[model samples]
Target: MKVINHIREVRQRKGITQIKLAEDLQVTRQTINAIEKNKYNPSLELSLKLAEYLDVPFTSLFYLDKSEENAE
Candidate 1:
């Protein structure tokens, strides 16, 4: 299953910049960019941190795309 996230949308709506978020989360801006672009899946700890920092529920920020789970 693929991981999908609303990190960018929520961040933008909340007027948070990637750099600021990364700094606040103690991560690199590239890491945030990668996650936002769906090029990387964050660690569980980071994921929780993101949700907390973004002021959103974990389920609201991230989910699995199971549509392809049974495709094989």
Candidate 2:
């Protein structure tokens, strides 16, 4: 399975920078970058914190699929 994260787009829509989001979530900018790139999946607590910070539903931030080609 593959997971996709819409963090960058959401942050852009909210007019927030990655640094700002990282600060709000108490994580590093690299962590946010990794999440956006699908290189790292956030923990449950981190996912909830991101959802709260972005003011979006958890489903809006992340998605799961069975195919790598269809994941994006």
Candidate 3:
């Protein structure tokens, strides 16, 4: 499934860099980069934490591709 996220845009709007966000999450900048690039999927707990950190609702932050749903 495609892990679509608005994190990059939102983070940019919030004036937060990947390095800063990673520090807040106690992870590495590469980890945040992976998530933003869709090379990695964060755990459910991490997803929630991300939403909390970005001040956005979870549903707003992450979503599965509707095309994937149609394939099911």
Candidate with maximal lDDT: 1
Question: For every model shown, what is its TM-score relative to the native structure?
Answer: 0.92, 0.88, 0.90
Clash count for each candidate, listed in order shown: 0, 0, 0
Per-residue lDDT of 1-72 in model 2, one digit per residue for the tens?
A: 778889899999989998998898889999999998999989999999898888999997888865866755
Regions of model 3 farther than 4 Å from truth: 68-72
**60: Cα error in model 2, Å:** 1.6
Query: Model 2, clash count?
Result: 0
Residue 44, model 2: lDDT of 97
What residue runs in model 2 are displaced by over 4 Å at the alpha carbon?
Answer: 69-72
Candidate 1: global Cα-lDDT?
0.95
* Evaluation by TM-score, superior candidate among 1 and 2: 1
Provide the lDDT at 58 for model 1: 98
lDDT of the candidates, in the order given: 0.95, 0.89, 0.93
Which of the predicted structures, 1 or 3, would earn the higher lDDT when compared with the native? 1
Give the C-alpha lDDT of model 2: 0.89
RMSD of 3: 1.5
Candidate 2 clashes between residue pairs 3 or more apart in a chain or in different chains = none
